[model samples]
Target: MNRIALLAASAAGLAVYAIAPAHAAVLPTDATETVTSCGNSRLQAGLATRVCAEITGTTVEFYGRVGLAGPPSPGGPAPAPRELLTTLSVEVAGAAAPRTQFTSALFTASNLEVRGTADTVPCGSTVRATFGVASYPYAANPVVHEVTVTC
Candidate 1:
């Protein structure tokens, strides 16, 4: 009877754990960003990260990605790549509030990405964005960039 009771409790615990909802991001999801041009990139510890920005109408979008910068060792076992945190920070010259988003917990496969946007920017307005990445515990890196695009 004790063995049966233990098994029943274990099954109930597993059911509750499986039914728990996952945490969702507060920011809007990206619409398939094509990182055609990368303004900044960092290669460190066999990992490569890139950050870019683009404008559509009055909205500005930012992107960040992390992947393997080099091949793994050909020794007995390959080292598993650690998780990287990606942050996209955007601020308009005249805007009151800055927009920022952080994506971690790893993206598809090996590459990781985090994206966000700043909206209502005027035509030919100067926008500042920073793309940052950190290893695991920390997320985000890189430099700041100023961009102006026609409406």
Candidate 2:
């Protein structure tokens, strides 16, 4: 009888352990402030001229919580890549507001030079460029804009 009781207790404990929540790799689900570019120019597209601005700053923010599969082996941390994924430029806008949608990852990091022409206005206008990984969402929406410099 005692043996049977011990076996049942062990089984129950095992069941509880299995049912309890086990820590899984937590992925970061948030947005972070990145770089900014300034300086814009007016250019002719087809019918009307367009204004393009450049923003300089840390545009890529880390997303997705990265950790070791198990506790750091031998007290050493697991290997994590320096760069996770490619950065996508959302839009270029004035007044620190992102006008374009951050949907496509079409563009890439350029040589910090102005190419196209912006038909809006010239430098001295407050322009903001927002970039981020499209997967993650912002929790608190940190301040992305600093000084409204010319660009």
Candidate 3:
């Protein structure tokens, strides 16, 4: 009886070890959540939320939101679709341009549009922007990386 009990316990422990995962896990959000709202936030029926991301780079920042603003009434079906609002704001960090390096050009020039550029920018740093939906229409939620800015 004693031997049987010990065998059962060992087998149970082995089973548990076998079932356990070999590695630490990574969550979907960790890689998927970009600065963009649509790319970062989960979509549901008739939901509207805004997300803003700030990047310090010479490249342009394109913005968009995720999910449709929900239905009109609590009991009613979902409302009409909401369109994306996309825009770009230029960011600068240090030393006024014309003399400032690309990384330190925090002040907004002609195309760049941003407020409080002086306060937000740090000295001597370059910024580039990139954005996209990793999962796209399917919603895989991939990470957004830097893309070179054009003149």
Best by lDDT: 1
User: For candidate 1, lDDT tens digit of each residue in 92-143?
Assistant: 7787676777666543335666667546566766667777766755444464
RMSD in Å for model 1 = 15.8
What tens digits encode model 2's per-residue C-alpha lDDT throughout 37-69?
222221111111112233333121111111122
Arranged by lDDT with the best first, the candidates are: 1, 3, 2
Native-to-model Cα distance after best TM-score fit, residue 25 in candidate 1, in Å: 30
Query: In model 1, where is the ten-residue run with the lowest total lDDT?
Result: 21-30
lDDT of candidate 3 over 1-151, digit per residue (tens): 6999999999999998888543311111222232221123333222332223333332223342334433357677644333322222332323354221121121111122211132233323333222212221332222222222212
In angstroms, the error of model 1 at 121 is 1.6
lDDT scores of the candidates, listed in order:
0.60, 0.29, 0.31
Q: Where's the lowest-lDDT run of ten residues in candidate 3? A: 100-109
Q: What value does the lDDT take at residue 25 in candidate 3?
A: 16
What stretches of model 1 exceed 4 Å from their correct place?
A: 1-36, 44-46, 74-78, 107-109, 136-140
In candidate 3, which residue ranges exceed 4 Å CA deviation? 1-49, 52-63, 67-72, 95-151
